[model samples]
Target: MLAKRIIPCLDIKNNEVVKGINFEDLKSAGDPVALAKKYDDELADELMFLDITASSEKRKTILKLVEKISENIFIPFSVGGGVSEIEDIHNLLNSGADKVSINTAAVINPEIIDEAAKKFGSSTIVIAIDAKKVGDEYLVFTYGGKKNSGINAIQWAKEVYNRGAGEILLTSMDKDGTKSGYEINLTSMVVRSVKIPVIASGGARDAKDIEEVFVKADAGAALAASIFHYENSGIISIKKYLKSKGINVRL
Candidate 1:
């Protein structure tokens, strides 16, 4: 059986690694380049670097940071933000990114998905969906969760899959920083809504939360930020916990 991956996510703002709750009230963590190297040395399955402000600010991805982060990490790396065209994807890949994720630009124009997939293959095109539960139904949000697209989360997942996206990085805005648990209902819906891999993000408080996302929630993989960021949680401990629960994971 294939071992499930444990990935560490980095939210980069102003060229520094940072984190926030529900995509608001940002705070610095450390130098992104230095942090990337640490995760690499720690033997993380993979690393994700997201320029949190790039989409909202309408700026290009930081190629310098891309090069710096990839320099030390042999594991696969994915980068996103302000990616709107094939050229943008091309530049990032050229800069050493193994994969590219698109969000807001994808919301504005989904055709970019097909174009990118055709150019880079489905394996390299990942779609990051930020969903917030509104009342009873989960709705999709864009621009760092600042704007709602009036579209349901499941529907958007299906649409992006049809557009040739390779994977879904589904994040629950409500559970983002709380670390209580994952949005199991929303995650199950997304995993069922699409045929591709679904990576669950947000609401990972402890090892139990990680186990639930993989077992009950049925996610392809589970990702966390602040818990791992603050050293309150370690990937090795989480991996061990997952293994003890009979889940396949790298030890």
Candidate 2:
């Protein structure tokens, strides 16, 4: 069985780690390098670092932070934010990131996914989707949820997979810090829509939330920030609980 992954997410703003509810009213957590090293020590399966403001800033990702975090942690790390071109992906990977995650950039020019997959292979290319529900439709948000892509989340997921995205990191603006749990319906909808690995992000309040994610959504990984950063739960806590749920997770 494929061991499900438990990942810790670091949302960066002004080069500092921050957490917020529904992706608003941010609060400082800690230095990402230190936080990630803590999760590294805790034996986290992987780490995801997102410079949430990069897209809005219309600049490149903070590669210096990527270098710092990558050097401090031994686990595979993926970095995203303000990634606009192939050079950005190349620079991030060369800077020590195991993979490069693109969201707004992918939405703007989905050919970026094809270009990246061809140059770096699908394993190194990740398409991240920030989405929220408006009435009956799930719309993709871009520029760190500041702008709406006007595309349906599930529709874009399938399209990105067709463009050769190896993985999808789908975050729910609806549950982004509610701590209620993963957005199982949204996740399951997209997972069943695409063949690639889908990672569920947002609203992981506890271990049971993660269990519900993998069980109900069939997510390949569950990524959360506050639960891990707030010391409410650790990687081991998540893995142990997932194991108890009969899911294949690293111990």
Candidate 2 per-residue lDDT, tens place, 86-189, comes to 99899889888999999988988899999999999999999999989988989999987999878999999999999999999999999996889989999999
For model 2 the local lDDT of residue 151 reads 97
By TM-score, who's the top model here? 1
Please write out the lDDT profile of model 1 over residues 1-251, one tens digit for every residue. 88887788988876877663222212423677667766666657888888766444334447777887778778898998777788989989988899999998998898999999998999999999999999888999998899999888899999999989999999999998887899998999999889998989998888889899889878998887767654446777778778888999877
Q: Model 1 reaches what TM-score against the true structure?
A: 0.90
Off by over 4 Å in 2: 20-29, 53-61, 230-232
Q: Can you tell me which runs of candidate 1 are displaced by over 4 Å?
A: 20-29, 53-61, 230-232
Model 1: clashing residue pairs? none
RMSD to truth, every model: 4.0, 4.0
Candidate 2 accuracy as TM-score:
0.90
TM-scores of all predicted structures: 0.90, 0.90
